[model samples]
Target: MNQVTGAPGTSRPGGRTARVREAVLRAAGDALVDKGIGGVDLAEVARRAEVGKTTVYRRWGTVPGLVADMLAEMAESSLPRARTGALDTDLAALAGLILKTLADARQGPLFRAIIAAAASDAQTAAALHRFYRVRIEEWAPCVNEAVARGDVPEGTDAAEVVRALSAPLYYRFLVSGDPLDAGVAERAAVAASAAARAGVYA
Candidate 1:
């Protein structure tokens, strides 16, 4: 009987196996960007990555599995939160990051595809939520620092403040089809800061 190994390309953390995983994930991202989740096929992804189909199947097993791994990688690679020494500035920095991502030519469509996939796939939805959770955790410190500095109320919910900063930008990107611009980012930061200061999140 063939020994089933751990997810292909993930068993080893580094070296040639790591490189193969990176290539496969990059190819997967490109495929998701070019064509929605439905367009991502294991055989085609392997071909694009120049890896063997058996390797891809052995590792990812299914499209949702591949997507979950991709989101995990993305969470790992996400930028660190801003440490600007003030609530407003830190919020501004966070808002700017979100704006840049949502407005990006490649990332915009990729996120749209991911969101669409999550709507129909429970695994993908869980992965997407986990990704956001990681990101929110990264930024929560800013709000906590603000509380320490008395910039916001003592009972303010740092995570909710962070989420508030991002909600409008995502709304524009995925709901209203409004433009995502610096002004919008600035407003998001300012509004979230004001609300936090008012103990709206307490």
Candidate 2:
């Protein structure tokens, strides 16, 4: 786990405290994207956010701690899973959401930078894992729903199915450099869904 939220004088979950957190996180994201994780610092984030440096230092004790909190914030801010009553539509919606996030101008590079950092930093890696765990758990229910509805086999691994749906998209974003589009996202959904139906994940 990361450091605690803050020291004394921290406000409860709204109002000025939330605004300050938002500003600092936005600044942190900007720094991460513009100069990579190596270039991020509490002071710089405070300056960018136009908040007091002491606030940042007190709230987040270290760089990894700060990164962890940033990821937690991201998880909290993400949209909830689709309960569209059909696996195909739910999977397609998730794939489209992943596509939009990975292809975004700011989010793409930011993720790239953070992923790179996670390769070397254990704390960042753990944080990344937690982030994915939250997201996967959020979407995994659709696979379970499919199983219940007989759309896929019984005992299909829900989290694996969710991961499988995003694997190719991440491959394109991180390795293959393939173009990401609505067509590609749809294909990924179709492929993963087909595989699940065929017991590939059973």
TM-score of each: 0.92, 0.93
In the range 25-118, model 2's lDDT, one tens digit per residue, is 8898898888878889989999999999998888876777777777777777788888899999999999999999898898888789889989
lDDT of each: 0.85, 0.85
Q: How does candidate 2 fare on TM-score?
A: 0.93
Q: What TM-score does structure 1 among the candidates reach?
A: 0.92
Model 1, 50-109: lDDT tens digits are 999998998888887888778777766668888889999999999999998888887788
> For model 1, what is the error of residue 177's alpha carbon versus the real structure, in angstroms, after optimal superposition?
0.9
